[model samples]
Target chain A: MGNDALNVEHSSGHSAAVFRETQDSEQFRRLKRKHRGFVLPVTAACLLWYFTYVLLAGYAPDFMATPVFGRVNIGILLGLSQIVTTFAVTMIYVSYANKQLDPDAAAIRDRLETKEGVR
Target chain B: MLHLAVTAPAAPGDPVLNIAIFGLFVAITMVIVFRASRNNKTAADYYAAGRSFSGGQNGSAIAGDYLSAASFLGIVGAIAINGYDGFLYSIGFLVAWVVALLLVAELLRNTGKFTMADVLAFRLKQRPVRIAAAISTLVVCFFYLLAQMAGAGGLVALLLGINDRVGQSVVIAVVGALMILYVLVGGMKGTTWVQIIKAGLLIAGAGVMTIWVLAINGFNLSTLLDSAVETSGNPAILAPGLQYGLSDITRLDFLSLGLALVLGTAALPHVLMRFYTVPTAKEARKSVVWAIWLIGIFYLFTLVLGYGASALIGAERIAAAPGGANSAAPLLAFELGGSVLLGIISAIAFATILAVVAGLTITAAASFSHDIYASVVKKGNPAPGAEVKVARRTVVVIGIVAILGGIGANGQNVAFLVALAFAVAASANLPTIVYSLFWKNFTTQGALWSMYGGLASAIILISLSPVVSGGEKSMLQGVDFAVFPLSNPGIVSIPLAFFLGWLGSVLDKKKESLEKQTEMEVRSLTGVGAEKSVAH
Candidate 1:
């Protein structure tokens, strides 16, 4: 896979041609699919949950004020839940990337770098 | 500035002790910064710390950079005075990190070398895009600097009882000089160390205060809340809407504020620049994880401290203090352990401002030198070692400007400056960044349109909003030209930016280079070619 003739300026169109080949490869596509598959929905869901909380805090103050237990109300509980959700999502993403995403990405990188004589 | 009924100007603690502790902190960090700057030989060394920091170290620095005086002091004071409503800000700030971790951080680290401009200019027309990014970066940094500087002035006034206008101005100048020295000597490597030390001290101090507050209430959270409500004589303190629930318009303002906070963190220039300090994308990811935990735990501490302050000192006295609500934490420190704790905690607050301003100054300097001077003016070829020298000079200029602005803004409500910075970042930078990374058809024209359009609209809206004019608490006193109903512009400007990006790309007949786009996509998704540049 080593092609001495293909080595040129990193930003030139010739090197980008090699990157284009990697971009179209099945391995590269699979890595992108895996990444977007995990990240997109998780991001949308978190944003949705966050906005819902914000809207309720803004518009439905009465609901947010409803007491849950003793002094803890719906607003306080919902706020704490947001904290929990944030930490949980971070851990989930990290674990998911470690198990599902990183290996495929690393393999694809190895192939690209080796072909480009970057070893 | 609206004059709140203030308690008499009496120093809360031993002023001499506070000054001595603060002096010690400055002397120690200055030594560390001097040691770190010895390695600043290349542009990479000056800008990204030679990509030398581990994930954990970078994470701690990121937490330090991200948690400005706004997060530490402002949010703490907000919660102490306004009850549940104040906690909302912490939630927004924290949740924004999820957007950063999942969407922005690793991809950015893999793609960009030093500044945010490196990524945005990667596939677009370098000259126009780089200039737009540098301008947006400088504006955001200046706004944030003003907030921190003004907060410093107020913090010192309350902590040491320096009430005269001239004394506050001198304090601002001294802080400016220290920030200049940190960046001039340490560069990014030194700045990162200062941030790390500050983060540790800040979290530790807040943790101590949180535990002390909890113990006094028998370690029961409900007991703390009950005491807060009982002391304040307002049961509404336990619920939402004390701050933002006055009317329908005020409620809408809360939504706008929430929108800005959630979207703003990922786009903030200084915050985004922190990703480059780590060598690999994996380290970037790990750094974000560490940052989320550290920042999350710190916010939790603030919650207890907020209600703790209300419970211990009563809301009336906190409201009546010299800096108004900003005085809560220092006042609570005085109440908790008398002068000694007050001295220590106040010194920590000063350290927070110093760490943050140094971070901002270096970031702005990097933007000016890397984007404007080297890339744009020199047309991408400068004499060896010229870039770092230019950066050092830019730091001095920024320090002077910040001192002047801080002195002018002293005693004003600096909160809106922070809000404006966030809104501009969310509206201007975030859309362009997302498009360049995710949208293949994103053209140079689209990038330019979104960057300039979003920046102008956000700034114009904020300037005309109630934050700057009209109402009693506005920055400009006794003016009524505020046509924008919402105090924050994010709800409107963010969507507009995204739309402009799409429309501009579609309208342009000439498309951006497909090869460049493909290259960027591959580089960002995988770590190929990223590590080599980072190592350089």
Candidate 2:
């Protein structure tokens, strides 16, 4: 395997022991709650948005037919916006990770590894 | 089934340029595979690309892997034939990335290494879940591969001037042989580089086609749409009635197809396997972001390519081509750009198939060697190189089966098969992923039930659906054998699979271990105690 960290696991149980400790820590629980709080609402919102577009396309042909501009109907406009929406949402989450999630998460990692190293 | 059993369309020139372009693409790809095979000394090197890929490279590779011939040829062909309805597929396919990028990538990265089996078996009882995971992965891969192989066989015949069935069989054999070699020797790194290069070429090639199409129409989309509506004689060129909203069955069918495309993309085993190629969860997320961008752009261009085909060549002529509407893209290339451009476009489409085939082959090989053979068959202690050896042999077997299957299928449209593949992925894989990662109470019983339940229901529903049973559009079209109302089964099978998973977990009454859940959560969230990479 190309993983030195994984190879070491068979010789010594250090990573597993460290993981057990990290799992028991309050910080871990906090991280889980924060992540769930962010991810669940986003998932729900995305699914809801996607289904709305699909359901509209399936059930309401006239509404989709109404053109917003000359020869550019509402359906075409809405379809194009789906691409825009994906990009916008992905960028939002990426920014959220950069600004909110990664920093705190990295701190927990560094602290746990240092304690393990000292031990 | 390879639709368009008829010969390739009558382009102005003979097959000289197309063959040359295709040969050049194959030669360059072989060089890449040769370089990549040298690094395949260890399991990680073979499977994860030594975790050496930068986020940008992996991201492009992901896009390449995700956008198969279906996106390039299928969607365009659908649009050319069905007008506005074909464009709806682009919306559904792109929307799927939102789920993959925001919700799934982090969890997949935290626990998964090598395969989706890695993620599912992370906290669950390993053996049963791994076995179930491997089986479902293979099933999905098999169907997906069959679709790709059929499409590739048809494509090869178009490019090489192969007229007879025997010639098509030879083409399938050659494709199968090359794909097997890439997986058996070059591994994921080789497959990935090929995908990245193909993605670049596809984007560039499609970009030029889109621009030239617009140039023909004086850079006005409405002009193109107007010509499309007029030529196609489909008033619903910019409306829903052309493809969907016609009848109750079609409406439901559209809904089901939309559901599968929107949900099934992330669940695809090959696409998911790309996640582990990067080093960290952050890189995985970024890779997804990149993929969404590229795929989104590619599909946007497809809008022009599809509509433009109707606008220029007229949808009737495109539909008249062998393989029906799928020839729209190639026909468009022939009409506007002549034989030279058609040759390049054909080469790119062929590369798209090859890159995807290589990706699928590697994932199947990984699932077999890592998930089943090493983890299940050998009880997690494989002899040195035994797993890799098994992986190599599996690739040969899969390649041969795929080639034979391609030859066996009568020429029919395989676009529906891609949708069915996605439906299977959504049904069989997605529920397991969602429940295992998020639901703390999710048990091994639940995981097994979801995978098997989803797999069986998807196959059963698809067998009963019109795609396999109804008319010329159906596998058994002439005789009325289909009892299922819809063509795709995601509308029914997906919800059933999720419910089965929930019911199984609730009923199992397995001993709850909060610590195990906590371990997975901590590692998944903070990226601590996750699998690590060592440079080769």
In the order shown, the candidates' Cα RMSDs to the true structure are 2.7, 2.6
Model 2: CAPRI class: acceptable
Per-candidate interface DockQ score: 0.48, 0.48
Highest-TM-score candidate: 1
User: How high is the TM-score of chain A in each model?
Assistant: 0.83, 0.78
Q: Which has the greatest DockQ? A: 2
Native-referenced Cα lDDT, model 2:
0.81
Q: What tens-digit string does per-residue lDDT give for candidate 1 at B1-536?
A: 11334545686889899989999999999999998888788888899998889989999999998888778777778888999888998999999999999999999988787899988988888889889999999999999998888888787787778888799899999999999999999999899999999999999999999999999999988899999999999988878789888888888888888878888889999988888888889999999999999999999999999999999998888888877787888889999999999999889888899999999999999999988998889877778899899999999999999999999988787668888899889988999999998888998889889988889999899888888889778888977899998888888888899999999999988888776788788889887777442353
Residue pairs of candidate 2 with colliding backbone atoms:
B2-B412, B3-B412, B3-B413, B4-B323, B470-B477, B471-B477
Model 2, C-alpha of B461: deviation from truth (Å): 1.2
DockQ (0 to 1) for model 2: 0.48
